[model samples]
Target: MERIPILRMGKFLLITIQVDMHDTTALALQDDLMAKIARSGARGVLIDISALDVVDSYIGRMIADISMMSKLLHARTVLVGMRPAVAITLVELGLSLRGVKTALDVEKGMELLAAALEDGDAADQD
Candidate 1:
């Protein structure tokens, strides 16, 4: 079992989850992350998946669930740093992450998240 590390970056929470390419662990991690996101009241979430070599259907569903949970918590979720191979695998498997947002790196993800938050704030002000 590996620990899921969560860090606060600006208004977003960056979560580094370690999965053993297993669905059980990934689902557990997703639940834990959702709980943390709700508790922390983060404006956005950045999930770093650079360490994962492969992603399966269950894990893909978990990722999608996390994205939905983030929106329910009033926070957006952005998957960051996905390996090219893993991305290709997911795409080939027809595991479409339709409503989820993704970025090539954490920095870009954070920038996008910040901009989204800013736009949301500006809209709210009007």
Candidate 2:
């Protein structure tokens, strides 16, 4: 079994799953991640997929599902660290991501989350 580590950075949570590049693990991890995010009440999420080499339809749909569920939980989810080859494969496979957000790296995803958090704070103050 692989380890799925979840870390909290400010209002953002990062979930890293160490698993084979397969959809089975991805789907299971996605469910666990969603539960953790909902329970933590995180404002944002960064899913580090840097270790993954393959992105099949199931995995893509799971990612998209998590993104939608995260929004319903009042948290934004971003898929980060996807390799160009994997990205191209996913696109070529015709896997629709719906409205899921993605970033080239975790740093950019964090920046986006921080900006959103600032905006949320401002809106709360007004």
Candidate 3:
């Protein structure tokens, strides 16, 4: 079983998907990520998909599920570095990723996640 590494960056988890993952690999990633979030008490998840050229419906749904699951576990999920072609493909397939946030790249993704975490922290303080 191939496993993706989950790196901890302060209160965030950084995941870079560099391969065109198989379904099983995707499933494993979902599981591993959830475990990492719980174990690390991460406040956010940043997934970099810049290297991927394909965004099939299955992959799109997996991303959505990962985001929702992360939210349920008290973490924000942000997808970053999506290519234009892949974005168009996802749109044409009608997967809006309704609840998932996105960024243009890793740096912006970190900024976005930081802002979101700040907002969350502020709300919790209230």
Candidate topping lDDT: 3
Best by TM-score: 3
Q: What are the runs in model 1 whose C-alpha is more than 4 Å off? A: 19-21
How do the predictions measure up, each by TM-score?
A: 0.90, 0.86, 0.97
Error of 3 at 4 (Å): 1.5
- Give the candidates in order of TM-score, highest first: 3, 1, 2
* Model 2 alpha-carbon miss at residue 55, Å: 0.4
lDDT of each: 0.84, 0.82, 0.93
Model 2: lDDT of residue 70: 86
Per model, how many backbone clashes are there?
Answer: 0, 0, 0
> Candidate 3: worst 10 consecutive residues by lDDT?
1-10
What clash pairs does model 3 have?
A: none
After superposition, candidate 3 runs with Cα above 4 Å error: none
**Candidate 1 global lDDT:** 0.84
Candidate 1 residue lDDT tens string, 32-86: 7788877888889998888878778887888898999889889999999888898
For residues 58-92, what per-residue lDDT tens digits would candidate 2 score against the true structure?
77887888888888888998889988898889888
Candidate 2 at 37: error in angstroms?
Answer: 2.1
Query: Which candidate model has the greater TM-score, 1 or 2?
Result: 1
